[model samples]
Target: MNDSAPSPTDLLSVGDVSRRTGVSVSALHFYEREGLISATRTSGGQRRYARHVIRRVSVIQVAKRMGISLSEVADVFADLPPDRMPGKTDWRRISERWRGRLEARRQEIERMENELVECIGCGCVSLRSCRVLNPDDELGADGAGPRLLPEIPTD
Candidate 1:
């Protein structure tokens, strides 16, 4: 093997990326399937990803930790220039959007904390707490399911 450094445009195999980024090959494939990342095929039909995918995968990891969903990540990526790797400016744009989402989530958590404090003296049972939270079975108005919770679409 030559001792020369690889070029910036070199493509990485799925396993190589997985090893470098701590993301599994299966997850990489899933990201590609979800349009969060893209890959090109070689003459033999093997998937190869641009080196920039490492940074992209790292961003995906951080976003998921912050409760950003894959669809949300895809939306953010969609706004970036399609012909190039995401630069600092592109990341900053997405970061600003994510900041808004995190701020909203923080406010929700604070509201829940205050509600729990209010419940402290009630000695409320599980169902009682549900009733107090739901108030007059309001969730039932949503057609017999947990209305406050988001419904996940299944494949």
Candidate 2:
């Protein structure tokens, strides 16, 4: 019987939340600092997190796995009211927003794949091949860079 353990009804300590969610304590701290998750402080100055933060951390993990940047994930969480934990509706809304970004990324990948197939061993990394490599940048109006790829929108 570990008398130091938090009771079932007590808010979870940062370590407890980390153990429950498999997220590092540092990451939890980062999330807290980034405003993706939040916590309260006990009178003794120990931090305490609500159980809902576990689910919130899980959602953040899933978003990261999907190639969504932390800023993008933060934007999604921004849609939720500060007082409420992300619920089913929140998940649905965020998922819908990510669906568009994911689909766009997929299409971009497909385009790059096809382009690479043609660019293989072409050795056309010169401006002379700009017609094929970058038709829009005929005079290098956009400056030096891989201009063929479309910019992925973060929002």
Candidate 3:
């Protein structure tokens, strides 16, 4: 038996959390500093977060990939009370709130699909003939991507 005293299963340190989440420690610190995620402090004042932080970090990464800013992502989780770890139901509710956003994205993709199909059979890339190109229906002149693509709501 190779047992010494079994090593203690320590809680995830800030660095440990970063390694697990593939986010840099500085970014983890930023998340905490910006009030995005919560953590416990040791007697030495080092930050320790629950393992669930992996999932939270994953959410943050996905939201950022979707072009959501940190402040905006923080706003998404702001109403969520951290005293209770979000279960599937809680997460589902949060996702449900984005149903409209997802559907709008879906619709925009469909519009592009039709445009692409049209372009394949005919030489038509004109904004006048394409819903995807003429995305003014969804967006104003402010952001990137198709103007017809609606902006993701910030609130």
Candidate 4:
């Protein structure tokens, strides 16, 4: 081992964190801005992250893949100490909190799949026959744009 190399317990540079976590340096900075993760500054003004941040970044990546927004990740992270790594107990709590939302998303996707099958079976490509997009032509009265599709809730 090179004596100049950082130890496992030592703080990691922004680039070090990026390479280890496979998350871009820009994303690490973004996470900092969003309060999802934090870092310290070196005497030269370089960013240095705690080694535990690797695990935190992994959690963030998984949550994002599951459709959880950065704000949501921030909310979960807020429940824990910013300076420490999240433990298994912390992860259990976070996963339990997110379970309902993930289930709801799953159900919505299943419903859409069934609706799509029904729409296809009807053999009418028109908006009139499309149950998912416009059921009973109710959207026609609303004056254009998608109607029956679930509206994406904004943060």
The TM-scores, one per candidate, come to 0.75, 0.77, 0.56, 0.74
Q: lDDT of all predictions, in order shown?
A: 0.82, 0.82, 0.72, 0.85
Write down the worst ten-residue block by lDDT for model 4: 1-10
Please list the residue runs of candidate 3 whose C-alpha ends up more than 4 Å from where it truly belongs after superposition: 1-10, 105-155
Model 2 residue runs over 4 Å out of place are 1-10, 130-135, 138-155
Model 3: worst 10 consecutive residues (lDDT sum)? 1-10
Residues 1-155, candidate 3: write the lDDT tens digits.
Answer: 33532222535798898888899999998898888888888799888777667778887897777655678667777877664456787678666766666688889888778767766766665655655566563444455555556789998
Candidate with best lDDT: 4
Scanning candidate 1 in windows of ten residues, the lowest lDDT window is 1-10
Ranked candidates, highest TM-score first: 2, 1, 4, 3
After superposition on all CA atoms, how large is the RMSD of candidate 4?
Answer: 9.1
Candidate 2 per-residue lDDT over residues 1-155, each given as its tens digit: 56754454768899999999999999999999999998888898888987778888998999989999999988987877764468898999899999999999999888778766776778776564534466455557756667678889998
For residue 97, give model 4's deviation from the true position in Å. Answer: 2.2
Model 4: residues with Cα > 4 Å off, grouped in runs: 1-9, 123-129, 135-155
Index of the highest-TM-score prediction: 2
Model 3 residue 119 distance off true place after TM-score fit, in angstroms: 15
Query: How does model 2 fare in lDDT?
Result: 0.82
